[model samples]
Target chain A: MSRALDTVAAWVLGALWIAPLVYALWAAVHPEAYAARFDLAAPLTFENFARAWAQAPFPRYILNTFVLVTAILAAQLVLCTLAAYGFARFAFPGRDTLFMLVLVQLMIVPEVLIVENYATMARLGLVDTILGIGLPYMASAFGIFLLRQTFKSIPKELDDAARIEGCGALGLLARVYVPLARPTLVAYALVSISHHWNNFLWPLIVTNSPEVRPITVGLAIFGAPESGVSWPLVSAATLISVTPLLLAFLIFQRQFVQSFLHAGIK
Target chain B: MRIRDWATGYLLILPAAAVLAAFTHLPIVRTVRDSLFSRGSAIRPARFVGLDNFEALAADPVFWKVLGNNLAFALGTVPASIALALAMALLVDRKLKGQGVLRLAYFLPTMLPMIAAANLWLFFYTPDIGLLDQILGRFGLPGRNWLGDPATVLPCLMTMTVWKEAGFFMIFYLAALQTQPPELKEAARLEGAGRWVYFRRVLFPMLMPTTMFVLINAVLNAFKLVDHLFVLTKGGPNNASNLLLYYIFEHAFAFNDLPAAAALTAVLLALLAGLAVTQFALLDRRVHYR
Candidate 1:
């Protein structure tokens, strides 16, 4: 009886949790009239999705987000690789203090300092640009932390052995450290991509043009109540906006879960 | 040789360190400094008006209300979500029927952007023709202006937030649980401890460090996540649901009050610093624990 009860409870919680998304799927696929109604016999069409796509510059928004995450990830990997290696291996002065300073970004993120960050961006002539949006996050403290922890775990003999092969500093990192930290790199990349793809407020504050704005900011404008909330259309747009990350997540579900787990445990 | 090594370390970290200095560190210092000065216009130049912004903050009712709402939001969402996440972690950790689908259902919300979640919930909260009202009407219940009413507004946001967050937090507990030795569970079973007893005595105590980490994160999230407000309330019905970050946004953009925004950001900084200390102290203790 107890086992059966537990099963029923788990299923109930899962059902409740998924109900909103299920409703969204229903609303997006059905006609506007069927948005609040449930009917297995309701005529389903893809018109809502077609209309939602044409209604906004979703392709451009998507393209901009893609560029943003790609640039941010590439920069993060390269910068974090060198920095993490420095902290993990070097016996430098103020090492712990510098590491602590880097860790500060983990808690007091860029979102909290929006007014000043916008000012900084404007001074640098990066406002309303994808580079402006990605700049503040490119140094990613979380990436450095994760990579540093991973790098520290590799045995010291490997470093000495690499040095014996006439491997210089960059060569040691490129051949030894980067190759070994591949799982962590993959995990951090996945986490960073999903985060930037879903990010909103900072992008909203920075980008005024649809040309530079990401999908999240575009979706916010599209769904703003003053524009008139058409449930089917908005639902369709929401799905369109999320479908890429959602699909990536569904396909690489285990990796995505593990990436988040890997991130949190550190 | 030591000098070359030290110089190499500095050179290696220069690129990332420089960017972090420009973006994170300098802005933090500037935010506090800017808070001391009032904005300048054509006729009058900008001038330092020390403590004036904070004084104004003290006098402003909206600031206090938003601060209170922020605390309430943290208190409401964090514990509830953590509990649900712990439950979820336990459920998915075990061998269960349709586990794949179950895990997918629980974890899906965490994948979508917060903006998307807000828009989706906005539709559901709409009156009369909304999914919520339609369901209520089936049982002869009246419809509610869910997001419009002051009473239900924060609760509505809280509900959506809890739904959005529980699954994400569950992953942390899941990670913690996965690392535990199987013998712990076996030992509990051998001692004939009931589920609740076993959980409270073993699992919960073992998960203390994770709980602290999640608590800090959840609190930080309450301060940061104001995307839903932009869609759902815009801090409406006399600013019933205005949170601190959203209030800062309103002051900065809507009212173009930079000094006020800086002051608010400073308060947020202090709060984050306090949490950071607490987290460090807790994690410090955990480092020496078994």
Candidate 2:
């Protein structure tokens, strides 16, 4: 009897959870008049998508997000790899002290330092640029920490063998450490991509023009109640911003799940 | 011919160190320094006014209110979400029919951007035409202004937060659960342990580390994740739902008061550092027991 109760409770909770997304789907595809109405016979139309598209610079915003996420990921992966490699393999002077400073970023995230970071960005002449939005996040402490632990676990014999085979530090890192820590890389990349993709406040402050503002910022402007857009259009815009990550997640759900698991476990 | 390996290591670490210092370490110093100064004009320039900004912060009613709201927001959202997440993880970890579908359903919220989730939830709170009110109408109830009313606004934001976060935290618990030894469960069953007993004695204690981690994260996130405020409340219907970070954003960007913003940011950093210390202490205690 309790087994039956548990299954029933689980299914009910699941349905309640997805009801919003389902509502978004319902409201977006139907005509504005039918958004709140639950008539099973509500006519479906792509008009909301078309109107929402015409109304906002979603394409440009999405392009900006794509560029930002990938750039940050690329920079983080490279920077973190080198840093993690340094920490894992060699005994550098002041390495522990520097590592502790880097770990400070974990506690004092970029979001908290917005006031001063913005000043630094202005000094660097990076304001209103995608680079400004991405720069503060590029040297991710979490990524370095995750990768350092992974790099430390690799067999020492392999490193010695690679060194004997004419692999310099950089070469060994590129060819050996990178490949060995692929799972950690994958895990960090997944977390980083999703994180920067969804990141808002920094991007909102840094990017003013539609040319550089990410889809999240763009969607915020587009759906701000003051804009007077209807629910259908807002839902459609929400769907557009989310569809890429949502689809990637659904298709690679298992890996997506495991990637977070891997990232968290470390 | 190769350089000393330690020297090479330093060279390898230079780029990340430079970036981290520029963004994190330097800004930290600047925030502290700036907080101690005046919001300068062209002629005046930034002059030292030690603790004046903090004095202003201390006296500001809105700051106190936002802090109170943040505390309530954390209090309302974090524990509920953690409990819900644990329950959801337990549900999915067992042998169940259609578990994949249930997992997908629960995890969908974590995939959507906060702005998008905020936009969707805004519709649900849209007074008369909102989904919540529409459901209420079926019972002949009148719809209250959910986001527009001050009393309801923070709770509304907290509800949306729980809805958004529980699923994300669930996956962490789920991950932790899946990695545990099956033998533990078998042994408990052999000893005729009830579900509640096994949960209290075995699962709960074992999941303590994950719980602590998630708890700390959830608390920090309550302070950090203010994206929904931009969409849902803008910290309004009279500064009712404003949070610390959003308040800082307003000070710097909206009001263009850099010194004031820096002071607030300093407070936030101190709060975060205090939490980090507490996390280490708790983790240390957990380790001692283990």
Candidate 3:
């Protein structure tokens, strides 16, 4: 009886959890009339998606998001790699204090300092640009921390062997550390991509133009009160905005889950 | 050799360290400094007004209301999501039928952006023309203006937040569960301990470290997760569903009051600092345990 009860409970919860997305799918595929109604006889159409696409520059939003995520990830990998190498291999003065300073970003994140960050961006003349959105997050403490941990775990003999092979510090990092930390790097990239892809508040605050706004900010403006809400159209837009990440997630479901798990465990 | 070693270390760390300091650390100091000055305008420049912004914050009812709502949101979201996550973790920890699909269903919400989740829920919460109302109407229940009404607004937001958070937290518990020794369960079974007893004595204690981590994260999220507000309510119905970060956003951008935003940000910073200390301390314990 208990086992049966558990099965029923789990299934019910799962259904409840996924019901919203399923509703979104339904609304996107069908007309607005059938959005609130469950009608088996309702005709399905791609018109809503067509309307949603036409209503906004979703193509621009997609490109902007893609550029933003790529830029952020690339900057993070390079910056974090060098910093992690320093923290892992070097015995420098103030290393511990500096690392603690880096770790400060882990908690008091960029979101918390929006007022000053906005000012900083304005001072740098980066407001309303994709680089502005990605700049604040390029030096990720989480990335540095994770990479440092990974680098530290590598055997000391490997670094010594690389040195014996006439490997300079940069070359050693490129050959030994980067090659070995591939899984960690991939996991960090996945996390960063999804995060910046979904990031809204900062982008919303910083960018006023659709030219640089990410999909999340674009979706918010698309559904703002000024523009009347059409359930099917809104749902269609939501699906389009999320499809890249959502489809990637669905196809690479195991890798995505494992990446998140690896991130969380660290 | 010593100088070269120092050069290498400094050179490598400089890029990351400089950016972190400029963005994270310096902004904090600058926020504090800026808080003492009023928002400048075309007619007059920003002038030093010590404690004026903070005084305004104290008197501002919206600030208080948003702060209370944030506390309520934390109260509503944290324990509920953690409990659900724990339950989901336990359910999938065992050999269950189609558990992969079950896990996927629960976890999918966590993957979507909060803005998208808000857009989806906005459809469901729309009065009369929404999914919830249609279902309720079928069951002879009245419709609710979920986001429109002040009373139900924050709770509605909390409900959506809990849905987004629970699955993410579950993965952590799932990871923690995997690390537990199977022999402990076998020993408990041999000792004739019931499932509840075994869980209460063994499992719950073992999950304490993860619970602490999740708690800190939940609290931080309570402050940070205001993306939905932009879509759902925009802190409407007289700021009934307003959170601190959203309130800060409103003050900074909407009201164009940078000083007030800085004041509220100062409060947020204090709260985060408290949580950060607690998290780092807990993380230290966790590191030692591992």
lDDT tens string, model 1, A1-266? 87788788889999999998988999999999898878899999899999989989999999999999999999999999999999998888999999999999999899998999999889999999999999999998999999999999999999999999899889999999999999999999999999999999999999999999999999999999899858899999999999999999999999999898888887
Off by over 4 Å in 1: none
DockQ of 2: 0.86
Candidate of highest DockQ: 2
* Candidates sorted by TM-score, best first: 1, 2, 3
Clashing residue pairs in candidate 3 are: none
Q: What is the lDDT of residue A20 in candidate 3?
A: 93
Error of 1 at A8 (Å): 0.6
Candidate 2 residue pairs in backbone clash: none
- Evaluated on the second chain alone, the candidates' TM-scores are 0.96, 0.95, 0.95
lDDT pick, better of 1 and 3: 1
TM-score of chain A of each: 0.98, 0.98, 0.98
lDDT string, candidate 1, B1-290, tens digits = 89989998999998999999999999999999999999878899879999999999999998999899899989999999999999998888888898888888888999889889998898789999887898899999999999899999999999999999999999899888988899998999999999999999999999988888888889889988898888889998798999999988988889999999999999999999998899889888877545
CA error at residue A231 for candidate 1, angstroms: 0.8
lDDT of 2 by residue, B89-199 (tens): 998889999999998898889888889999999999999999999999999999999999999999999988898989989999998898899999999999999999999
- Candidate 3 lDDT over A71-170, as tens digits, reads 9999999999999999999988999999998988888989988889998999999999999999999999999999999999999999899899999999
